[model samples]
Target chain A: MVTIPFIWIMGDLLWNGWDQLSFSFVFSAPQNAGREGGIGPILISTLLIVGVCMGTAVPMGLGTALFLSEYTRHDHVLGRLIRGSLDVLAGVPSIVFGLFGNALFCQILGLGFSILSGGLTLACMVLPILIRTVEESFHAISQEQRLSAAALGLSKTTTIRRILLPAALPGLLVGIILGLGRAVAETAALIFTSGYVARMPESLMDSGRSLAVHIYDLAMNVAGGNPHAYATALVLVGLVFIINVSSSWIASRWTSCNRLSA
Target chain B: MPFSTFFFFTLRVFLVGPLLWAWAWEYPSARAEGERLIITGSSTMAPLVSEIGKRFETLHPKVRVDVQTGGSSRGIADTVNGLADIGMASRALKSQEQHLNGSVIAHDGITIILHTSNPVQELTDDQIRSIYTGSSTNWSHVGGPDSGITVVNKAEGRSTLELFLDYFHLSNRDIHAHVVIGDNEQGIKTVAGNPNAIGYVSIGTAQYDAAHGIGIRLLALQHIPATLETVREGRFPLSRPLTLVTKSPPAGLVKTFIDFAQSPQVHDLILQQYFVPLQG
Candidate 1:
């Protein structure tokens, strides 16, 4: 029953977006708000934002997950507090994150409307999920694995670096991929933070538009850009699909390779 | 299908759900409304129409009044197609739209708005033009702080943008805006957030928000204030007629609605919506 609606939507995207997704449409900056030209800047901004968000999120998420899982007792007050906070943060709506990002980065930090502000906002949004999932992955790694490394006379840090991390690698990748998905799909938080200007960002401080915002602009506010909006959606869906398939494939292969070597 | 494929399919479906509904749902007509007067058009004039509609409905209890907003273009199109009894337009009718009769109901204008914390109280006409055209880039360059000036512009399909472009003698492509926002509130919010930002929006909207402590100030153009009194007194230079457009000269319920909209009874209502009434 659900598949029927799902197939119908895919057909619609193909119908609306097929002819409009030309080479120049994917490669050139928009002219007339996607009425005449293309979505080049939007694509670049999306990549830059996702890159920055992931770059910040991965290190912070991994470090926090490692500390909470390894250093603290299960019920440590601070750990509980951190976990509780992460849960609450994950529940916070994206629009609230947009407002917070506007206040902190755009106004207080004086970053203004730029890709940097939006990237930071998405990083904060993805952090909660990344930390939770990564922590669970660490927990799922058998305690016997850690003990085995300890019995081999390896120091705690060395054991963690060489053995524990390697065994938990697939799980950590899964967490990161999930965060990547959220970052790529995020729209509301970026709306206020990233100024919706359809031009190539000259610097990190320059405001840029993402595909999601561009699509919203073209589709909603007026009539002339409807065709372009549908085409942009098709491109966005295709990009997300490639990211998901490749990342999960890499994780699965790495996990199997580790098992065989062990 | 695999779980991943199904999950991905579901996500795409969810995203397109609204589009599907829009495509499937039939456009509502006056016939569908039943004993109601359907008004459609610019979002700017929507609130005023509803206010007047409520008053008219009370005066004639049997007739229900419904107002919907898409934009001015939708207004003209709906009226031409007989989908609406009256179309609310925030700008004067273009020459191509001569077939429809547009009655001037009130007046409003696009005016420059700045954050209350901004030091520059006003700007010269040339400076305002330069700022929008990318000639003036920094606030300090324009008698303000050292921060770069953020220019917030209206989106396409808005009458405010149309009036702004016409008044300044600038093309849409000439606007070097840092942000493009839809509707008056978004423009006000953008200006309120940035200390060095300037935007053009309806003067009435700016005045109303300023009174409500929204932390934005409307800058005088050519040294004439953009207050309600000034707008009424014909001192505001960037003003546009707020018109009630009908496909042809209105009659029956449509004519009554138009007459009521332009009458003295809605003067307070117009003033409350931040518009200058066309008459005493």
Candidate 2:
């Protein structure tokens, strides 16, 4: 039943967009409100937005997960408080985050409607999910490993660097991939933050349209924009598929290498 | 150990490389800042303004025009707050917003639509209100077949919905919609597919789609035909101007861009988007 919807959507996209997909379609700037030309600028903007999101989210998520798993007991008041807030944040609608981001990042911080603000907003939205996933991965590590590291006279930081991190690498990769998927597919949060400009971004401060936003505008707002909208959607789906497949491949290769070393 | 080290090294490079590249690109542009005009507001007017901005950019090589869309209210707010060089509002500014200067570029009309298969040729204002409010659920109640009427309404936050409500003297809460749609095309599609469905959408979009044999019909209002000619003549009761607003009198690049937008050179572009250019 689940696969039926997926197949149906893929078939529809291919049926409508296959002829329109070309090298120029992916590499040229959009003209006439996306009725013609390609999505080159939009592609770069999506990449930069996702890159900024991952760059900020990974470090913060990793640190928070480590602190939650290693620096405090499971029942510690502060840890519990942080966990509670993260859980709540994970459930909050993305539109709320978009509004908050617009107020804080775009207005207060003077980032204006730029890729930086959009990326920062996406980072905030994905952090809770990333941290929870990574923390669970950390907790899944056996206690015997920690005891063995302690018996080896290793410091807490050393134990984390060598033992916990390597052991939990798959989970960390999963967390990052999940966060990337969310950041790339986001539309509501980005529309108000990164904004609606379809120009090629020369810098982080320039407003550039993301692929999802382009698809949205072409599909809903622009009259007779369906052909290009379908093509853009097909490209987005292809991107998500590639990200998922490559992440799983990397996870498997890393695990096999670790087993060989052990 | 070497494998893990290599992996972390690659990861670090992946994360930090983009940041470094972004900063490097920013440096040269920062030193040589060019003229940038930011236009924000009204999703309805955004596509047209974007096309105009593109032509404007080609004419002025060094200048950049950035267009953003949220809604008409956002356009007003952004303009008043000085965040935008110009704001695009599809409707005229209210009395309180009169402080801002508004220049009309085009006109768009909202029209009632039905499936062409529907036998009802016309409806009075009272009939439409009754049908929308659920007081009249059958087409027979409004001089049509005895089948049930499906009311297709625009979703909340859509300017179309707001305009619809304003023209009909009805609030959103009073609407008993059978199907809520997001855009003009969607509403037209829904009504086209359903023999008994009635909806309202942009007259230009409806006319284009109907001409292309989309199985939808545009209904006249108050005995006047629902045609582009009527709208152009300013006889359409439910029409709104596509306006460009500024906090202060436009000067410099902003003034030049607005003038170019209103000039006859872009009338074909305006007509191409299915909006009526202001007649000289």
Candidate 3:
């Protein structure tokens, strides 16, 4: 049963593959019905959203992980509450996060439907996952590393920024990769919150849509389903592949550096 | 017979699988063959199209109709681009959209909905324009409660808002500051929840009571109620035609869909869905 669905999905892609794999369709925007349009700007917008999401998520998620693993080792009430809150926040669906983003960032915060709002919402979704991954990395590091850093008389913050972060870089990169994938693939939350203008995102606050949203919009929103839905899907898959491979390569490099230093 | 059966089985494994795969990937075109009619656009038109699709599919079991909803601009865009066999729009076409044919499937009243507790009864045309355009920012200015008017608006390019702007001549107005929701369902919920909030939504989605909140009150404007009669008679200013646009005038299955959509059964379905039929 599982194999059949996958086979069908692949077959669908293969059947449409040749017509969809054209460079012009990849690069052009839609002019009208029964014609062609490039999705170049949309592709860039998806990348930008993923980039901004990572930019915010990495620091925040890393900070949370550091606080939990190193700073708040002693059992405390506030720490426990914060941990509980993080769990709840992570558990919340992407749609709810989108609603919150719409209200808090887009409306109350007055950042209109822009890349910034979508990225920030996605950051909120990814934070818990990033934090958990980073925390696990930090926990895996021996206590001897922390003691040695203390022996060097480095400040707690400095140790976290330099010693612990570099040590946890491999796992941290994994968290980032996962978050990037989520941000790139996510649609429902983005539809209402991000605003789906096709133009390239000039600033953080400009309204934009990702590849997934673009595909959905084309298939479900537009007539004739845009004929390029498969192409867009292919592009999204390709983009995800690029991000994962690059992140994996960087993680491998970082791991090698850590080994050499050790 | 055994040799032939084995040969056929081999063909199924290779040719059938590859063909099916190719069919799946082929720009949503089913060789432009068979009895598949793909319809997309206008969530407002979705319910109506689905009803027609269900009946149509039953009549011709070999035929399949896929209905998808984006919104009206998308519907028009899809029709112009040949993505949909029919693009259902709640608003009229733009001047640029003259390239396609827009047939009115139904008519809808755009209700000025408020929280049930809101004592404000009516708004003038000028007041409506000012409120939506953000000139009059509070209910106190409009002879309502002392609360600041929370103007919830549909996102830009939404067909409903497009019609409202054109009807009221508020096209150049800056509505970017309003709390912009995407669909009619969300707009109805937002207004129903907040007593100080005012928003416009289709009459179909406005009828249901909000989740654990007060039902919304459809405001009367300038002695013209936002009702079925007022909308059909063209007394209500916010009323607009709902359409299913097609590329180059639909033929075959597309023509059939348009025909069924324009029929009395569809009109009855529209009535049940709380939308006034085009003929009505």
Model 2 residue B269 distance off true place after TM-score fit, in angstroms: 1.9
What is candidate 3's CA lDDT for residue A104? 87
Give model 2's TM-score versus the native structure: 0.96
Share of reference contacts found in each model: 0.00, 0.54, 0.00
Cα lDDT tens digits for candidate 1, B172-261:
999899999887867887898888889988887777678878789889989998887777788789999999999878889888888888
lDDT of 1 by residue, A135-170 (tens): 998999899988987888989889777776765666
Q: What would the DockQ be for model 2? A: 0.64
Tell me the interface RMSD of model 1, in angstroms: 15.8
Cα distance off (Å), candidate 1, residue A240: 0.4
Candidate 3 docks at the CAPRI level of incorrect
Please report how far candidate 3 places residue B264 from its true position, in Å: 29
Over 4 Å off, model 3: A1-11, A33-35, A152-154, B1-240, B243-280
Rank the models by lDDT, top first.
2, 1, 3
Query: What count of clashes does model 1 give?
Result: 0
lDDT comparing candidate 2 with the true structure: 0.90
Model 1 native-contact share: 0.00
Global lDDT scores for all candidate models:
0.79, 0.90, 0.71
